[model samples]
Target: MLSAVSRALLGALMLSVAAVAAQAQDFPNRPITIVLPYPPGASTEQVARMIQPVMQERLKQPVVIENKPGGNGSIGTLAVARSAPDGHTILLTTNALMTIVPHVQTMPFDPLKDFVPLTTAIRGILGIAVNPNVPAKNVAEFVAYAKANPKKVHFGTAGIGSPQHMAGLLLNREAGIDLVHVPYKGGGPAVNDAMGGHIQAVIATVSSVIGQHKSGLLRIIGIGEKERFAGQPDIQAIAETVPGFEATSWLAFYAPAGTPKAAVDVLNRELVFALNTPEVKQKLFDLGLPVVADKPEELDRRTRSDLKLWGDIAREMNVRAE
Candidate 1:
């Protein structure tokens, strides 16, 4: 016993709910695209490619990887942020986009509000490597050398305000050193300069310089992770010397903010399943990225925490992208 208008409103609401449920059931009816906000050879891109097949199989749709590198990862990230909130287009990017860049540069979208956290796909530790000519074999010796030399020691990073740059800033504050930062176009150039002895030190990912370290071209002075990386147990964690030093870079999956909760849940389930597969885990581990199939809330918490951490560091260091 309801008025005509009230009955019509109820019917319309029911229809809307049914439509959303149907859409969720047929989630990803079209091919899904994962936008990598960095160049192709980056660790994020590599990890995306590795997970692509498994995700496709799980979702029953082709998963495409699209690279759109520019503006320190903001260009492509903004594209994903502006995409339809239908789960068809998603972003697979690093913490730098949400945690570091926004603090240093003006972004088109709000990092916290424009996207929904899906999962943290993988995490990799940074390495404190030095040119072989430097007389530092450990974190203590390296810190001592840097302190003794002051601004004479140059530390090369991927770019200004990058995670590597933040790591350098943290190192200076925690270890009490005055090493100068030399910004490079990317980690490749920075690593190359360190290898060629153009720079005394470089903070880079383990995958970027592990081969060189093994070949004796460069020496890994310390690991920037709280615990030792499983792939390289012999390398000691920098925290042992610096007392609570830990900096890591991670790649995470996110969808547009208004994507249906059902769609988000499906994507998270498929992604977590893919990450837990033995072969996928093995491949990621081989590449120095440990699989971290954390729940959505976990990633969200981490992202928010890192945003504050890097924001404070940026203000203190007066870091801005060049």
Candidate 2:
């Protein structure tokens, strides 16, 4: 009787392993959805659109993009979390939604817990841009102007929990000036508002406003990286003025937690292939984003590290949502 019980347990374990393997093999039998947490025209959406065709061709299944914008990207992120772990649904979002937003607002899903980071697609630095009509030409001038105007100078961002929002907050503290925060549903609108002179400044992904910056519609005075962007060295680093200020962000891909290992592997392999394509690389470079195309483990490590770093910073800054 003892031997029979042991044999039965072994059989059960074997069945479980076989079931998981089968699930992985059959993954993406249906259409795959890549959920965009923000509205159309954001950098995240552009990234998704760039890779969708390649992914579909490689996976041999239709991949659709779904936009669900609100709650600083928590709503769409949570939808992916609650989805089946069969790898049919994925998420394309910025690191801010994972690292900074959760610290400011009560997130419906835990970014680190509820999703598996597939890979980092592209990396870009945050930039500070103002309308051409603004008198400030650089970070120092901007700070002095803000000091004189105090809370009247309105600064906009993609959203309250965005990396831009945190960068703006840190600028206010480090520069010893007050600039009111304005949260937009997406980066596209915020940049537009700045170009239209409705807002005094905006901290956004360089990709979103580089075209306008070159056209004189908006002037990018400072980048939030520790050093100036190599592609556009004319703009000084915000750190040069504020000291120790940085807000680098990445566009990453994710699947729901508990997804089959095989499925995750397939997605990672194909998506990396798509990002490495020459056409895609050129487009990203033109938009001021450097192709990261890192492995799944790399993204996992970054997500964990950034989560801790941003969480502490959020608390120290006492950053509240808009």
Candidate 3:
């Protein structure tokens, strides 16, 4: 008893539903490429490589890591954004690039709208370290020293608008001290400069500075995370001295928006399984990214939470990439 027009629309809707089911059933019909938007050999890249084999085995597809490093992780991110949402292509990215930097830089694709998070598998920890030559031993002591020396106490970060930069700026604003910031091409170079005494302090990954901290080359005065890292319990959290302080970054997997929910669920299952693998878990810890492996919904919730937190920090602090 339906009208002809209504019958045609119903048929189209049924066909669309069937097509989605078929697509999900045939997911990863070919190879799966994880686009890493950072340079090779960085922790982000290392994480992708570490999980590649496990995912390949579980998904029964050739999982390849395509490095598309540039524009502070935007060039490759955009490429994935524009890719087919058939679950064949995914982006392995961070909170800094997704939530923090987006507030300051105009992007070709909307981060919050263009991607669907699969899961958050790991998080990066940041630390504040100073040259052994610096007299400060703890964050409180360091703040006092910075207040006395003013711009004389220079701090280096991986780059402008990076998580390290955010951490440094928060310290400056809260402690009411002027710690001159020197941006570097990478965290390694920033930490190296601090080690050589070219800069008084450097904000970088806890993993990057841990060896030097143990070697007596530099001292980790405080950790940017709310609590101390499990591996390094001796280091003090910055919040111990500066109330409510935390600057951390998490790496999550995402597919272009409109990717089928079934495909996303499949990818999330495999991604979480890969991360929890004993070998992958130990390596990630060694690399200084503690395993999170949260659900897709949790990843989405965390992203929204960080957008509000870091967005406020970036705006109030006037942090910008350009």
Best by lDDT: 1
Worst 10 residues of 2 by lDDT: 313-322
lDDT of 3 by residue, 161-236 (tens): 8888988888888778899989998888998899999999999888888999999999998888888888788999
In order of appearance, the predictions have TM-scores of: 0.97, 0.87, 0.96
Assess candidate 2 and give its TM-score to the true structure. Answer: 0.87
Stretches of candidate 3 above 4 Å error?
Answer: none
Model 1: per-residue Cα lDDT over 186-208, one tens digit each: 89999999999999999998888
Deviation in Å, model 1, residue 112 alpha carbon:
0.5
In order, candidate lDDTs are 0.90, 0.87, 0.89
**What's the residue-level lDDT of 168 in candidate 2?**
87
lDDT of 2 by residue, 1-322 (tens): 5598899999999999998888788877889999999888778888888988998898889999999998667889899999998889999998888888788878888888899989898887789999887899999999988889999999899777778888887788778998999989767799989988899998898877888888999999999888887788898998999899887888899999998889999888988999988999888877888788888899999999989977877898787775
Regions of model 2 farther than 4 Å from truth: 25-28, 133-135, 144-153, 184-189, 192-199
Candidate 2 residue-pair clash tally: 0
In candidate 1, residue 96 scores what lDDT? Answer: 84
Task: State the lDDT at 8 in candidate 2.
Answer: 94
Q: For each predicted model, how many residue pairs clash, with residues at least 3 apart or on different chains? A: 0, 0, 0
